[model samples]
Target: MHNKTKLLIFASLLLAACSTDPMQEIPNRGDSAPEIETSDKICNTSDDAVAGSLIVKFGEEAIPSLEQNALNAAKTRSALTRSGIESVDDILNDLHVTSLERVFPEAGEHEARTRAAGLHRWYVLGFASEEDLDKAAERLADVAEISKVQFRTRLYRASDCKTYPFQATANGQTRALVTADFNDPNLFWQWHYINNADQAVATTSVAGADINVADAWKLTAGNPEVIVAIVDEGVKYTHPDLAANMWINPNPSPEYKNQDIHGWNFAADGPISWGQKGDSGHGTHVAGTVAAVNNNGIGVCGVAGGTGKGDGVRLMSCQIFSGDLTGDALVSSRAVKYAADHGASILQCSWGIKAGIYTSDNMFIKQSPMDYEALQYFAAQKNCEALDGGLIIFSAGNESTAMSGYPAGYRDYISVTSFSPDYLPANYTNYGSGCNIAAPGGETSGLSGGEKAGVLSTLCSETSNGADYGYMQGTSMACPHVSGVAALGLSYALEKGKRYSLDEFKTMLLTSVNEIDSRLGEGSKATIADVSIYRGKMGTGITDAYQLLMQIEGTPCLRVALGEVQLIPLTQHFGQGAEDLTYTDIQMSAKDMEKLGIKAAPKMYNGKLMIKCTKPGSAKIKVSAIAGGTKPGTGVVMGGMVITKEFAVIARSAGAANGGWL
Candidate 1:
């Protein structure tokens, strides 16, 4: 045989080997292979025809090699007779391969290789015809080198419907208001921040119903080191309220050079733009709730927008959804990986698959392996050293059902449900065991006050380069509130030189909530029969910003002996050198002591409170440290400001102890 003919024959054989069913070559391929299935149920939809897309996991093969193998396979399949094809390029013209791209190169080489070994390289392939795409996916599934294969699925934003305009009052009544700062005119209108008892300003305001952001702000508005990634449609980064707190990429590669100044738009595969004309205002509103510039003398106040000193947590716009507010699971996963790889400490996602689309029993049946791997990779990255790991928060969904949606329903993410100003579950908020916590998401209808009480935050004008504000209600709105509160908790932890692992942080958040059912006289109920399937099933309770910070600050818990005299050494609880503090310097209400049935007064005997328990109950006691007499010889006046600590005292009867107590 001629040397040239031998080489050609060898090349054809190599292509044939690459094109054949690789899985058939595996030992016990049938037993080990993942089941490949397709359904008429729409995984994704667009104005164009429903193009068939597949997520293929190429095991042990680099992306470049996988692409070459795919090309060879395409050419071999296109050729009617191997001997008749002249070149790979000639056969390529006969094939209609629309797209074949790596799903998550941004996950980085080392991490992807280490964490997701056989599942490292995920490619999304699109075909012109659904029939052709289905056949291709089946062929890929048969390849031994491929570990997993699934149809690319789609996800939608948790709907945030604006039932009323921004300034429209439910009753059309004008009322007096109080402002946190003279510059922030709209601060008085933010009932979620400070729910004052005044009915005129906040017709629906319930005392202690708010997140208590005002008290948290006094400790530390926010630290600029914290970065939260808003994974939504797109944020109006240029909006005056959000511009200052927008995360600017310090370093950009040649491909993203000068483009990703604010953040990346994963939907467009380019730099971030707010959105084109006729876009929904979801992302901007969500961003504003997270970190709109505070005390700007314009717009509503953000929960953690700082004290107008350029110290707010920065927000990175990870635009997964587009103008039409639609997105696919593949891009959304990439956006998550990008946020984790970048500097974002907290990822606030107000989007998820619709709940009724997949139930818990069949969830894994239709689960996309690509998305599962990407989220797992993200969960492993410790982006926030201060918090011990990265945090991802999601909305529980607005289906008004008991179940949660995907990603949010995933154990790795914190699922937040919505609660109205009346402290009831928002009419549309999903509830069940999956809900990690509840926050004020707001509701505009079905209230006696006719209160259009949806959350108010910064928004963008429908036209021109302008900014506006609006009210939107959903678990979408509630998710960001938790994100902002988590930021505040992180800020407090960092300042206090305390650190918590991701799980520990979640525990703290869960434990810090006020027991709403107990407070509402619905003792021990997991779910509200009127609203949710299971009573008391909502994870932990409603998030309390003040309590979360207090937990981070190492507040002490007091266990009092009922009907007996007990002494709590203040110095032990408050740290050393507390003996110099006096009784008058410590602050506590007589009403609080009365509630606990404790006759207690701050009579410091070596910096300890002398107390007598009159009965058995519980009360929260607040104490403050006063300035110690000037330090000897230094002439330095110390402790001018009062540092307060609230301690929860549980008084138990001495002789009435139950066997369970022992």
Candidate 2:
């Protein structure tokens, strides 16, 4: 039924919407190395082949002793030769060692010492056979000049290997079969989807409430529209609930026309499909919360979280992972660049590989120009290529540790952590100096032993065998909420004709956050120093649509009316027995008074307007009128009257506003 209703909404909007357009996608950051022409075709061609994992590092001592190092290298080469190893790229092209240092010298001294102290080490190429590896290490170990010769193993699953279908396992239920090794913790974290529960109280209140959507509307119903770019598994494009909110990029070019579902798949994983109607449910659930079709009386409501609801902004899907196990930072970076290159204002990432800082164990070494440069290059791209320097929201991870994870720990992005409905941080959420904010991810309250997870809007799985609905919790889930709020801010800016760079938006989000509890710990409490550290840090606090709209345009007055009072300047206050200041019901006789300028009353409590009701239950109220034609010389009457106090005068409404008082 929910799907059907969503389809109906999509139908209506599709009919009224403009047609699809073309796209002129920019190329990846730089050109690739020209393919080597192999006349014999003997070299390995697979990106995941073991030969590709060869790692080597050079030190100042090793560089200066070129002949000695080469002699050591020859001994190692002989061992590899005896073991049937075909290649060794470690030999220097020239023995010319220079006294001048290259690369990070300050850090290099520490790195060199760390190596001597058994911290930063060096490695030669890994081989397919252990016997070969041992032989090579033995040859180098025999050389007196060579201080160390170590052989390490690194796994290489083919980059184009078998694709694993998207699957989710939770609470005794499993959505899809695990074709590959699903039990591996590393593999699981690589593709998992989590939840967001920033406002569990408010979210659950509305989710479980019986009130209709129309009445629940506010000035922010759809105000401050946001555009969230999901860079993960592909969304069910035609999924009834998610179709309408998908962004439709308006321009197309001949080279790449009709790319306007505002979505694209970049994962090497084969045959990507929207986990819909026989698909994986991960992307569907995410889409539902981000901008699922709302108010159709079928499924759940998205956090549209603002007024003016035009299908609640838009969602752009950039698929970097599919059923295939081919996901990597390189691919993810491409998706990031794509989202920015297009009009996607904000990017939401829920996937990443666990990689520590560059060390000897890293596939690439710090001093080596080829591989290490490639890894740091992406971080550079995120900072340089993003549109308007758009913000990227990332999950802090579910590990519950002090160690910062990649991308989330990148510091350049908005790292969000998860909180339960009760406002306590989720036990599973990872935290450290990098975490910027926390949102409700959902868990029961009271019991110290309870899960206390975060919660937010949910969606039906595109892959569900039978469209199911339930709650999920994690920092992964918490990220989209911030993303949605960012979208809302963007929409607000667009609607009000205001401009905000990504930096300014970050400023607004950080400062505007409603600090319910000082859960930031003893040392982490926000202070002047912390604020400065976070200057332009966490994007403006959770977006406040009402505040944004009001800031954009001064308050617009509606109609003002006074009940049963005529012929004097209205003085409203308690005359002994009357209700306190708020009881007065002042209605506007005409909304048109907004156009004609007259005397504007005090909105704040400083002065200008006063409320005085005579002596009690007599309950008599008086009102006076002044129009544009009132003579300039007329004396303003400051009239006061006293009557018998009887019953109290309760304020039904409040002020008469600016124009005229009736």
Candidate 3:
């Protein structure tokens, strides 16, 4: 909400910049060709498009070399060729075009898929800095070989976001104690993962308003098979908590020797530029939320971080934003394609075009064709065996508007909205039609929790005064939580030997949620929002990790009324034959029992399990029974094979017996 005191407490210090423009190095060969007269037609443009840059798609029938993925072929053979000029290079040379290059690299892993989808035809053309954008576009459009011409537009970037660095002794231990899931001390302050309603965090914090990763951690913390691409700024790969989880390219391009092993820096086309002026580690924070190392007695815990092993989902940094070089369609589109070409199945995109810039997908595609095709290409990729296509998650803009910004508002992908520790929409989070899910992004506006009210994760030591962890808040923070959960869900699916199509998996992800709309009570300390206004606008509800895993496990999620003792029929999970089977025992871990506040020993009665849940959360419990025989048969007796089934017990105030939590 941009509270002044909160800014003073957590805002990142603006780094002094004395850098030169990175775009001046492009070579110009326009002087050697015939000059074309400038056209007077007005440019169909917006303030969002970057100056002096245009993306053009070559027609398949005209420029077959580019359209057919003929990497070594020349652009033109003669001046009378079908392309309207001697070549794309010579033809563009007459129109102030400095350089022309394909947006996607030459014949990579998914080149066939890209070519079939028409993404191979996309090429970026850079013009002289003084060239008029409209005239340049008009001239390019006149070329018969050019199928489409669009201006390069900038994506969202926040180089100076808030940063509250971690300290050794006083910073972490001073907070009131609560059980933490990870050994990292700072995890206690991360109310977004597992809010325990500790007054020390925020007096208004909701008890179960977290992603419910705690219980899911017991089933499967993470699996290394899943990879997520952080398509924002360059990540500090050397950070201790993130280094081990970084994706290693087995066949690294020779140009990227020691550096760029994790992923290439598409922004500068070199090593990750973390030390640049105005760089505030926004990508690092987002990366931490997705796969930061866990239980190593250091930094914060990632949502998919493994149980003290190097088994977390790998993170690949596809940097599109670096310092003053906020991304253009030319660079960012390359990062998206790079993620698909590499082995990333989940794309963690925290940025987008400006809020309200182009609310509809048609407008976005028309204004920025390069980006649209890039995203379309990524969505068609299958990097992991468990999912048919990649999962691309974007943040609903932080503009406090009802309509989420594109490409998050595009509807084809998952758009995340932000919620607070109090379970209300964050003042800056955009909600309504486009938002697909809600997450705890934290809210630190005029609140008593200070930095504790915000989401905490890893940061660059240089940006955070030599500390490698910090706190920040935005829909940017919320998007990664969803990405992390999707990664973990895929990890669990792999463990369970299950597979799903992209659409099938997303339906489970969206349905695996808890109630949020019903919690909009006017409690004075909750929030400044007229939270009731966000009732049905905040997507399905808060995302639940345990519930998603349960969905993946093919286990029935039992809905129980909150704060009440009830009997849940086992038939729903174990089939109708459950009543005929002889039950041996029902078991649950002590931590899980406490997590659900089950004071009574859960026992089987009349083929049903009875228990009381005093709070809201999701937990896993096991039931063992004899399959064939009525009771357990010893060594000499004929008996049924012992069978065990796991069920996800979810407690919520607004759930029904029909299995609908929302």
Candidate 4:
């Protein structure tokens, strides 16, 4: 039956049968209600509701009737008082009557009304106790005027705060170091930026196996305009390396004007401090990796932190995790919306739903409706003042399985997997086709003598009141690498007056990876075959910062094969005056050809360059073009200007092909 019709029939029945007291007709209920059960699940919130809080959903056409019933029940119960007399005004005063409000209220009434008009069709109804709330629900249950009634619950973070004890001294003495110099003294210890010959300690020959951030830094370190919202635990804005880069809200709402100087703390429902007291510093660590002040002679260098010139990308703390490494899902959803609406270009989330009892084989679980809608809303916030669209990145869970949890598994977001120092998938990182990229999320446990192999960044001691530094390992650490690189890409684009849609930005990030399969063996399996479940499935290889920036520059060098007699096609474009003409402008160094063991000269064949190699080697080939008119003898205008571009050619021998093409 229609809801309105049902409500009318139910109201008529109540009027005809009860006439005097509606509370007396409620079934299966005494003066008090029974307690509900609670669970230990990550987001299961059977016990999270405030003591007297209840969420009641009244049918669209039954709000007035529901209110009248509640008033009548109060009046009927008050009549049974010791005085044996009651008035509607006395009942209202004794019952503490108040208007129903939204469960998750938005910033303004219009926004709240709009959201309520959508999926969230519930209200916050307060009572003196859970019993009162339950009794109200029982009274309304028989009436079709009510759709649903339940206690309000909350969701919290699943990951624990993992801190490394070994990074500190045996005596637990803090190091007193100067941080005013141009370069941080500990810069040499950052292996993810420049792995010195893949050595865990000591700075020697460079391995050049990292994201190649140093080279990209030369082009553009970062711009302050790009804001990356760290949507995890609250960041410690007081940390020196991070304080300079923290984003301050220019026009905060009155409720948060004093507290939200840096960013809003959704968990605490106030300004972004280091969460409630005793909170874990997960968000602070992630923010440091994204844009810690560089060259301040500080502890570490961030991926996109400027050259100590105070020009790094800004950091916003969307604190989802509170005192513990957990928080309410409703609060988290709100934080995401705030980040998207408040001008965050990139959203970095290093936490997600945990796969508690379910193993990798049964990992098809989905996200809640509210959580999914929050992500979708953020994804749709394109054309922000600073960016074309907001990019959402999530950490592939650290479950050591081939399954990723949502929102990482969500198709619209970029999922990042963990790669160890050896450029292999970290043993604990969850991986699958949903993984969009990989970064160095270190493995400190495998090293002997308790070496610090984990990713290093800013940290604050649980006991100490001051800022510090330490190491942490997880897909959490891996996520910010991509976020920072994305900031760099955005910085470059903004510098060059280029605007890319979110799709274009994601395409650039995914396509510009170092091919691990080509470098390592086929499938790019881990060296220890037993734990190689991620073989051929860990996204598009690891992220390459240099390559990504080069692609953004729009002059990427091409690679081709030579020994197989490959044909290289060319599309030549010239000035407006000169059209419909072609010229032969292929150039190759004789020395390079001899060095590469190429016996045949490259010849132009029907608008393509054809080359043959007699032996196995690599060489650089240069291609150039000049414009000419279609009329005879109007050839080679613009003084035969050579638009020289270099391309790489690799010649593989037959013997190598027969074996593996390593």
The residue-by-residue lDDT of candidate 1 on 1-662, one tens digit each, is 01222222333334322332222222222556554332322222232222565665544323344444444544464311111123322322333545555565422233323233333345565545544544554555554445555665667778654534466333322224343442666666666666533364345445455676665676877778888999987788888888989888887534354477777778777777654754667888899899888877777788778888898889998898776535777778778877777778898999887665556633633354456555665566676657877888999898887777777877768989887666667777777746788888877665433334678787767532343777778899999999999998888887888888989998888776754453333222122334323347556777777677777877665655556676787676667877776444455578766655555564456677666766433456776665554322234744354566777554433322321211
lDDT for predicted candidate 3 compared with the true structure: 0.74
Instruction: List pairs with backbone clashes in candidate 4.
Output: 156-327, 157-326, 157-327
Give the Cα lDDT of each candidate.
0.64, 0.38, 0.74, 0.61
Indicate the residue-level lDDT of 419 in model 4.
68
From the highest TM-score down, the ranking of the candidates is: 3, 1, 4, 2
User: Please, what are the lDDT tens digits per residue for candidate 3 over residues 1-662?
Assistant: 01222211111121111122121111222345333232311123735677767777655444344322222223232111122345554656666555455566553344456556666556676667677777677767665456567777678842127877755445443345446567876677778887767666677666777888877887888899999999988888889999988898887754344365889788788877676787888999999999899888887899998878888999999998887887877788888987888888998999986567777776766666667778877888888989999888999878888888878888788999998877667878888868899987877664567777778899988877887888888899899999999999999999988889999999999999887766654433334436656768889888989889988988878766667678878886678987777889888998878877888878888888888888767777889998887766679988778889877888755433443322
Displacement of residue 655 (Cα, Å) in model 3 is 11
Tens-digit lDDT track for model 4 on 1-662? 01222222343343322221111112222346332221111122335454454444434344334434434544454321111123322432454544344333333323432233332333444446634544444543333333444543443332345655324332211112111123765655556675534344322212333565765777888888888999988888888888889888877665454466777877667767673565767788888889888877767889888878889999989987777535544567778877776778889998876534223322322214445556666676653443567899989878776766566777778988886666566677888756788887776666431335677788765523443776777889889999999999999888888788788889999987764444334433332454334556788877767667777877553333334676656553233422233544667899768855567887656556678765433456766555433222436633434455556554432212333323
RMSD values for the candidates in order, in angstroms, are 10.1, 19.0, 10.7, 11.3
Is 1 or 3 the stronger prediction by lDDT? 3
Worst 10 residues of 3 by lDDT: 9-18
Model 4: what TM-score? 0.68
Candidate 1 Cα RMSD after full superposition onto the native fold (Å): 10.1
Model 4 misplaced regions, further than 4 Å: 1-104, 108-160, 165-182, 201-206, 275-278, 355-367, 448-451, 462-467, 518-531, 557-641, 646-662
- Give the TM-scores of the predictions, in the order they appear: 0.73, 0.48, 0.82, 0.68
Clash pairs for candidate 1: 22-144, 23-143, 23-144, 525-536, 526-535, 526-536, 526-537, 527-534, 527-535, 527-536
